[model samples]
Target: MTRMTRLTKWLLLMAAITLEVSATLSLRAALNHPALYVVVAIGYIGAFTALSFVLRAGMGVGVAYGIWSACGVALIAVLASFVFGDALTARMVMGIALVIVGVLCIELGSQAAHTRQTREGEATP
Candidate 1:
């Protein structure tokens, strides 16, 4: 994909993360107030729509899903701690850190594979 396309895919992925997080928070609210279910549904639908665009833009499913889920989990956890007064224990923090690291590893691995393919193509006369 062109540089612009790649950039756009990444942006869409970010939007997906935001929408997913919003959906999760709305879910929490909906538990106490059923009227919030509409908001929750809208958030989830928007998130998946943006995620499909990211995948359609030539981003591998694994990498796209990894980033989307990792960021979504981390952000929701942090937001929960602040907004809902959820516990923020050391173990929870450590788990979040691990998830972030794992996603980074996947992303780096994908980039390395792409670079190798580009080099191989260049060397093919």
Candidate 2:
């Protein structure tokens, strides 16, 4: 598989994240009014399409999924409080912070493994 450059991969991942968040928000809007289902479906389609591109760019599945899911959960929670008037409690804030930390750990671990493999390859005859 041809790997994309890190910048390209990150850009794709960001796009995927944005689309996924938009989809989740649209889902909320759709719940109250059935006519908005089309918007929700389109948003989901865009999200998955972008995510597939991100995966194809050779990002590790675990890292990509961890970041995607963690960020999505956090973003949705905050957005819900603003858009839906849902309460954002202290517990929710703490949970979101933990999720961010977990995703960062996954990303850092993936990067370390890649760096080690590159160093090993360079050391070989």
Candidate 3:
């Protein structure tokens, strides 16, 4: 893929993550002000739509989903602590760190697999 195309896909994935995080936060807020449910609906719908585009942009499903979910989880947890006064305990932080590490493994593994496939294909013919 061209550099621009790859950049566009990454940007769309980022948008998906942002929208998912916003919707989750909106869901929390809607508990107090029911009208915020509208935002929740729109955010989730938009997030999924953008995620579909990310998949269509030639990104592998496993890598895309892993990054999207990992980012959404990390962002929501940090934002909730600041926006809602939710406790961000040390244990939670550790869990978040582990999640990040897991995502990194997924991404690196994907790259290695792709490289191996390319090399095998080149050697075949």
**Candidate 2 minimal-lDDT segment of 10 residues:** 1-10
Error of 1 at 4 (Å): 1.5
- Give the number of the best model, judged by TM-score: 1
Point out where model 3 deviates above 4 Å: none
What does the lDDT come to for candidate 2? 0.88
Question: Model 2: per-residue lDDT, tens digit, 1-125?
Answer: 23447788888889888888888888888888888788778877887888888798888889988898899999999999999998899999999999999998999999999999999999999
TM-score of 3: 0.94
Full-model lDDT, candidate 1: 0.95
Best by lDDT: 1
- Can you rank all candidates by TM-score, best first? 1, 3, 2
Clashing pairs in 3: none
Rank the models by lDDT, top first: 1, 3, 2
How high is the CA lDDT of each candidate model?
0.95, 0.88, 0.94
Off by over 4 Å in 2: 1-4
